[model samples]
Target chain A: MKIEEFSSDHLDVLKELMNIAMGNATASIADLLQAFGTMHIPHLTITDMDGLKSQINHTISADEKYYVTKQLFGGIIGGEFIFVMTDESAANLGHYLYDVSQPSDADIMDAVIELTNILSSTIISRLTEELNTKVQFFAPSTQIISGNHIIGQDETLNYHKIIIVSTEMEFQSHKISGYIFILARDETITRLRELIDQKLEELYA
Target chain B: MKFLVVDDSKLARLSLIKTLKEYEPTAECIEAENGAVAVELFKAESPRVVFLDLTMPVMDGYEALKLMMQIDSNAQVVVVSADIQTQAQVQVLALGAKLMVPKPINSDKMLGILQQLVF
Candidate 1:
């Protein structure tokens, strides 16, 4: 199962799943922040490993791409969930929570962590119940990326297949984007296909 | 009993204090804006029990718990947060936190936990 082939076949279903997951996350955040906000998840697209690497390298300037938050979870559905947001986004979220009209860059890091904590937990909870499995989420790790650093590159080339789901969030009219990548083990693809098929059947039936 | 409550949000801390006061009139409560200050208060005052928020600036509840345990392993810490997910709840419990209480601080639930911990 090549990355492109898998993405082409499953992108729509993956997008729908992400929408459901993120909707719950968005609501949870709104309740926590005591502010009403809306989440808009654009179409899901599969980005090949090479494409993702290039995109990340190009989007972040060498000096600016230093910090990242990575969380991994496993259960009936297993994957490496990654959220890449600029320092600006983090501050923006924090300021929004504080009801500040304009948030300064100083506040973004804390805001980013808070937002990530709430969003990640909400998504994991939804995934656990939907998949009917005991999902475990590790503590999130913050890392510094210098220049064009690529993740999951050192592993066996066989696991290059990645499923990318992009989420855009609007809070207090401020917009931020979050990305979740489902990196499937070689044997896991068949199981995912079965799950998707079952979901489709339930949706139609 | 004396209780020290730590949370980054002023609103949340205020609400918790209000609820505690309502549930236990004689409860002497102190407040800290973040986990680090809470730890400092814990070492200085050694309150009977502490109500800690999981998310905050400077130091989060988990880090504060590690520091408090190092100071006194028998410290009683209860986590209060809006994050009620099973994974987070399990992780906090596994870390030796006495109880995981969800937010919006239902009066009955808060009183129930307090009664168990206090009495």
Candidate 2:
């Protein structure tokens, strides 16, 4: 089925599934940081690469430098998770995760990668478990960009249409926030549609 | 037998209302898309119990809970949200929430919540 063919029932089920998965992931993050965090409702959208770029533009402002992390998860339903956080947010993460008042550059990168792994692995793992699928995660990479340098500029993502599952996570007390984008392209979209269909069937039946 | 169901997602509202009806078949449920409307409904309708979601557009559950408590100290609001952080739980309880549970409320969980309610 085409991405546009997704019905309201399908989107609702998908959003609920995301809520459950993200709930579990947020608990893990809270435990890791020993702090409280809030997750926004998961937003599902089907868009081209340019549209994805536009969303990133809308989410991550051009005024501040950001440390963007990307991790790929592969299997029948494979996709990449992109996490974007401002430089100050990254530093705050380092401090909170490691209790370092003045975290170095390496400290910031390490903290970002660690946080990304926790967020992506817990979320995707729970989501796949609900879908009855298995996935393998690759090492994550981080890049520092400022002033109009978006994260999705990689030439490899040339798909005509992609599914973007996006959310925002915030630790209000710590003043740290990040935007997470999970991109599923081509075959992955088809697989997601099938999985969602099965889920809807189970729910309605 | 009046209850307020507040969530931005129609699916969540439907799911919760469906589960709730199994326990209280004659329960009247009022729905709201966001916290702003929820507060208004709480003021006007005065639902016996409220099932609120934390992460929403316009206003969030935290502010809504605070307002509801200010309007009526005895208001019963159960926070159903994706944010399961311990601090979130503490924050809501401190704000006078009756209970804080996670998303996707099923029949069994709904029964437990209802059984615990004093009203």
Candidate 3:
């Protein structure tokens, strides 16, 4: 599955919408941390299943591995939203928010969970409003591991193309990045495509 | 009465504005993208109260607080941020901020603070 399924205009709208969504996420995070900070909206990219796998692998290096938190939301718009943060980035965010000279592993874990909650909630809210759909989100589950853990073989699992959008944030002097991935079934994708087309037509007209 | 809100995020600013409207319907609300503009606006408008975000580009909350203090020692400036740690809270408190509120701006908490400062 290629991102070409959606028109450039659709992608543009999605990107803009995600920018606002990500901003909300950071704002909620800032509120949660009680720290004054700014979030820079990162670039968004659309990728196929293979592309996503490679992207995930490339993002997690030997020195800096990725921590992923997965949450399922059901209702008007339903799908899995995954937020990926680098271990180093998570530590920096924790220290910055807490105003601590150093951060503990527990601090990093707590921050990741909190940050994921904010991002997921904000994105889901925005998506629902823009799509004019009613959706529900389930509890978020998290995984923190090395890059090798992500790349290890798991033949039993079924694979589908995922839409990944990334945003970079700087909070309290810490540089952190956020990723939102929507894993959809084929039927869901069809509905999403129709929604995108309708939105694009409205935008252009 | 007029109020000034300072934050770098558009969404936060929007959220804050929406919440403030419920509390102060007739109060005029103004916004600044960062602390520097916030200080400038404070000097020009002398708003009844100021909602300030601590971390911002060009100038941060501490510097902005110092500037506001130098301009108007009795300024009613409230620190609004997401960082809730004890040290950060104490640091802002020491900077002469009248009060500190966490982010997402709870309506009840905000009304309490507003009632204490403005009423």
Candidate 4:
């Protein structure tokens, strides 16, 4: 079934699964940074490229410069993971990750990519394990860009429907925050829906 | 006893309620989709205890706990949120929550929380 065909029960179960996955990533990042952090509840939506862009733009301000990272994962269930963080947050992350007073640009880039890797792998692995599936992740790419351009204006989205599972991670003491978006489309959505259905059957049984 | 379970996800609320039932077979539950609704229900239902989730749309558990305490100083609130940061736990407790436990509550954890409550 397509994303629009998802029942309320399916959406609810998927959301709870995302919550558990994101929570695991939050704890992992907290340990890496040696700081306590909070992860917001996951927001799941089915939209096209334009709608996804609009949602991201609404959540992230257009005034700041951000470090945007993207990673692709493929298997029975596959998707793209996008992470966006403010430039200032990236710098703070460098200091927190590398313990440097004034980290150079290389330090910032390295830290951002590493952080993205940790978040993507932790969240995807946890989610896949729960769904009884496995995935292989590709190397992530990072770029410094304006917040407005964090999500590229590529209208050439391959799929007619996109499933976006997004959340925010914040560290109060470090004043660091980031947004994570997991996008899946095409056949993956069908597989995911089936898995969610199986989970629902188990829940109701 | 009557319990109030608050969460944006119906699955979460259902799971918590099921575990609560396992702990107390005859217990009654009232569900709220967010902290705003939880507050309204709190005033109307006066549930014996509340199991709250911190990150919810419209309103969050922290605000709800603060408001609940203001309305009834003796309110019993246990935050069951995925945000397990130390700061989050301390903040909820400072706002007068009886305790803050992580999400996906099972029967044993529910039993522990129920036993920890005086009334």
Q: Pick the candidate with the highest lDDT.
A: 4
Q: What tens digits encode model 1's per-residue C-alpha lDDT throughout B51-107? A: 987656688887898888889888888988645555557777887888988664658
State every prediction's TM-score relative to the real structure. Answer: 0.50, 0.89, 0.55, 0.89
Order by DockQ, highest first? 2, 4, 3, 1
Candidate 4 per-residue lDDT over residues B4-30, each given as its tens digit:
999998888888887788768888899
In the range A1-205, model 1's lDDT, one tens digit per residue, is: 4333453325555544454566567667666665445445334434456755665565456556544667777766676666666555565566676667776544565566667777777776765565455667787775546545536547446335555555555555465544444444444455566665565454434
Could you give me the TM-score of model 3 versus the true structure? 0.55
TM-score of chain A of 3: 0.77
Worst 10 residues of 2 chain A by lDDT: A147-156
lDDT of 1 at A135: 69
Q: After superposition, how far is residue B85 of candidate 4 from its true place, in Å?
A: 1.5
Kindly give the stretch of ten consecutive residues in candidate 1 chain B with the minimal lDDT sum: B81-90
Q: Per-residue alpha-carbon lDDT of model 3 for B1-119, expressed as tens digits?
A: 89999876555666677777778789798899788999889999999898987666688777898899899989899988654445557877888889988654768978988898988
Candidate topping DockQ: 2
In order, candidate lDDTs are 0.65, 0.86, 0.69, 0.87
Give the per-residue lDDT of model 4 (tens digit) for A126-197. 899989999999999999888788766666864568889998988888988999999998788889999998
What's the lDDT for residue B15 in model 4? 81
How much of the true A–B contact set does each candidate keep? 0.00, 0.67, 0.00, 0.49
Q: Candidate 2 DockQ category?
A: medium
- The backbone clash count of each candidate, in order, is 4, 0, 21, 0
DockQ winner, 1 or 3:
3
